[model samples]
Target: MSVVGCGYLGVTHAAGMAELGHRVIGVDVDAAKIATLAGGRSPFFEPGLDELIARHLANGRLRFTTSYEEAATADVHFICVGTPQLGDGTAADMRYLDAVVETLAPYLVKECLVVGKSTVPAGTAARITSMLRVLAPAGESISVAWNPEFLCEGKAVSDTLHPDRLVLGVPDEQAEKVLREVYAPIIDAGVPVVVADLPTAEVIKTAANSFTATKISFINAIAEFCEASGADVTVVSDALGYDARIGRQFLNSGLGFGGGCLPKDIRAFQARAHELGVGQSLAFLAEVDAVNLRCRERVVEYLRKQCGGAFTGRRIAVLGAAFKGGTDDVRDSPALYVANLISQQEGEVAVYDPQAIENARRAFPNLVYERGVLEAANGADAVAVLTDWPEFGTVDPDVLGEVVRSRNIVDARHALDPARWLRAGWNYIAPGRPALQPALVGTV
Candidate 1:
C-alpha cells in the first residue's frame, strides 16, 4: 500500500496500515519531511503517532521516500494530500490532489485502486477518475475510490485503527471489493461500512464538518443570548444535553472552532454549494463562520476590560495556543489570534502551552513565550485561559494568584471553575456568565 503526502493525515494513516500487517510506503515531495518520517519521527505533534511510526519503522513494515516512483508497485494507493482553502476565495485549492493524480498516473503499470482519503468537494472523485483514464498507462485497469478519513488530531491513531464506521465511495463492485480487502481488518472488527457512489462519499466529510461547525456556532449564539438575559450558558448547555436529540458534543461555548479542518472545511463547503447552484440550502453556514470569528473578538473584549479598560502598558498571560487541546497544530488558533490582538494593542503578552509553544512561536513570533504556566503569568496584570487544555483547568489558582500583579482572570473557554478562582482572591469572568467577586480572605 502507498500513502501520498507525509503530513498529519498521511503519517498516521501510513503508520496505522503498517501496524495492521501491511507493508506501507509513505511518499512526500519534501525531502526533509520524508527524512523525518524515515527516521521514525513524526514531523508534527500528534498523540501516539511518533511511537506508532517508530514501531512500524523498526519492524521494516513502514518506510518513506520523496520519490513517487516507489509507489508504483503497490496494489492500493491512498491519496491523503490536503485540500487547504484557496487564499483568494472560500473554495478549496485542489492543486495537491491534482499533483498526486498527475504525478502517479504514469506509474500505474498494473491493476490498482487509487483511493482518495482527503476531504474534498463532491464530484472531485469523478474529475480525478476522468484524469486517471486519460493519464495512466494502464488506463482500463486503474480504478478510483473515495474513502474519506474521519480523524481527530489527538485521537488519530485510535480513530484510524478503530473507526466507528467506514465509508467507501466506488464506481463499481471491483473498486468496492478492492477497498473492502484493504480495510478487511477494520471491517472484520464489526465496523459498519457505508457503500455509496463517488459524490456521496466526497460530500459526507464536508457535510459532517459543516454540521459540527453549525452546532458549535449555534451554542455560541445561544451563549450570546444567555449573556443578555443574565443566564448561565454552561447550565443551559447542561440542560440542553439532557435532551437525547441534543447530546453534548461541540456544545461548549468558548473561543469557537479553528484548526486545519473545521474553519476551512465549512468555507469550502459553502463555496462548493454556491458553485453547484444550491447555495441557499447552506447559506446559514456563512453566519456560522461569522459567529465563530466573533467569539475571538468577544474574548479580547473581555480581556481588555480585565486589563482595566485598556491593553496599553498591561502584562497579559495567555494559556494555551493550539486551536484546541491534545495536539500542537496552531493553524488559525484562537488563542494566538487573541494573544496577537492584545500584543497589537501594546500589551506585553506572554503565551504558554503544554506542547504548542514552538509552533505558536513560529506562527506568532512577536508574542512573548514562556517555559511554564507560572512563568507566563509572572507579574501579569491579568490572565486569560483561551484554550481548553486540562492543565489550565487543574492549575492551583492560589499559586497563580501569587505571581500576578492583579488577580483578574477570564475563562474564555469556560474551562475553569469560577468558584475556584473567586475563592482564591481573584475576580473571575467568562462569556455569557455574570462576573463573580473574590471570596473574603480566610473564608471558604
Candidate 2:
C-alpha cells in the first residue's frame, strides 16, 4: 500500500498500515520530511508516533520516498494531501489533490483503487473519478473511492486504529466489496461502517466538521448572552446537555473553535452551499463564525478589567499556543490570537507551551518566549491560561502565586482549579463560569 503526502495524515496512515503487517511506502514532495521519516523520527509532536514509525522501519515494512511512481505501483493508493481552504475562505484549493491524480494516472497498468482520505468539497470524488478516467493509461482499470478520515490530530494513531465509524463511497458493489476488504481490520472491529454513493461520502466529511464547528460556536454565542446577563454558561451548558439529543461532547463554552479543521470546513461548506443556491439553509453558520470570533474579544475585555481597564505597563503572561493541546500545529490558534492582542498592549507579554513554543515563535515573533512556567508567570500582573495542556493541572498554584506580582489569573480554557488558585490568594476568572474572585470565594 502507498500513502502520499507524509505530514500528519500521511505518516500516520503509513505507520498504521505497516502496524497491520502490510508493506507500506510513504511518499511526499518535501525532501526534508521524507528524510525525517526515513530517519525514524516524526517531524511533528504526536504521542506514540516515533515509536510506531521506528518499529515499522526496523521491520522494513515501511519506506519513505519523493517519487509518485513508487507509490502508484502499490496494490492500493491513499491520497492524504491537504485541501487547505482557498483565499476566499469558501472553497478548498484542490491543486495538491489534482496534482496527485495527474501524477499517478500514467503509472497504472492493472486495476487499482485510489482512495481519497482528504476532506474535500462535495462532489469531489466523482470529479476526481472523471479526471482519473481521462488521465489513466489506455485500457488500464482505475477506480476512485472516497474514504474520508476522521482522525483527530493528537490521538491520530488510535483514532485510525479504532475509528468511531468508517464511511466508504464506492461506485458499485464490486468497489464496495474491495473497500470492505481493504478496511477488514476496522470493519471486523465492529466500527460502524457505512457504504454510500460518491457525493454522499464527500458531503459526510465536510458536513461533520461543519456541525462540530457550529456546535462549538453555538455555546460560545450563549457565552456572549451569559456575559450580558448574570448567568453562568457552564451551568447552562450542563443543563442543555441533559437532553439525549444534545450529548455533552463538544459543548465547550470557552474561547471557541480554532484549528486546522473546524474553521476552514465551515467556511468551505458555506461557500459550497452558496454555489448550490442553498445559502439560506447555512446562514446560521455565519452567526457561528461571528460568535466564535467574539469569544476572543471577550477574553481581551476580561483581561482589561483585571488590569484596571489598562495594560499599559502591567506585565501579562500567556500559557499555551497550539489551537488545542497535544499537537504543535499553530494554524488559526486561539492562544496565538489572544497572545498577539495582549502583546500589542504596552505591557510585556511572555508566552510558554511545552510543545508548541517553536511553532508559536514562528507565527508570533513579537511576543516574548519564556523557557519555563515560572519565567512566563514571573512578575506578571495577570496570567492567562489559553490552551488546556494536561500538565497545567499538575502545576502548583501556590508556587505560581509567588512568582506573579499580582495573583490575577484568567483561566480562558477553564482548565485550572479555581479553588486552589483562590486558596493561594490569586483571583481566578474563567469563561462560561461565574468569576472565582478571590475576595468573594473563601480561600479554603
TM-score of each: 0.97, 0.95
TM-score of 1: 0.97
- Those runs of model 1 whose alpha carbons end farther than 4 Å from true positions after fitting are 435-444
Task: List runs of model 2 lying over 4 Å from the truth.
Answer: 138-140, 435-444
Worst 10 residues of 2 by lDDT: 435-444
lDDT of each: 0.90, 0.85
Which lDDT tens digits does candidate 1 get at residues 1-444?
999988889999999999889999999999999888888899998889999999989999999998888788999999999999999999999999999999999989899999999999999999998999999999988889999999999899999999989999999999999888888999999999999999999998999999999999999998777776666788889899999998988889988999999999999998998999999999999999999999999888878877778999999999999998999999999999999999999999999999999999899999999999999999999999988889898999999999999998988888888887878988787877742422211111
- RMSD of each predicted structure: 3.3, 2.9
lDDT of 2 by residue, 360-416 (tens): 999989999998889999999999888878887778988888899988888888788
User: Clashes per prediction?
Assistant: 0, 0
Q: How big is the positional error of residue 114 in model 1, measured in Å on the Cα after superposition?
A: 0.5
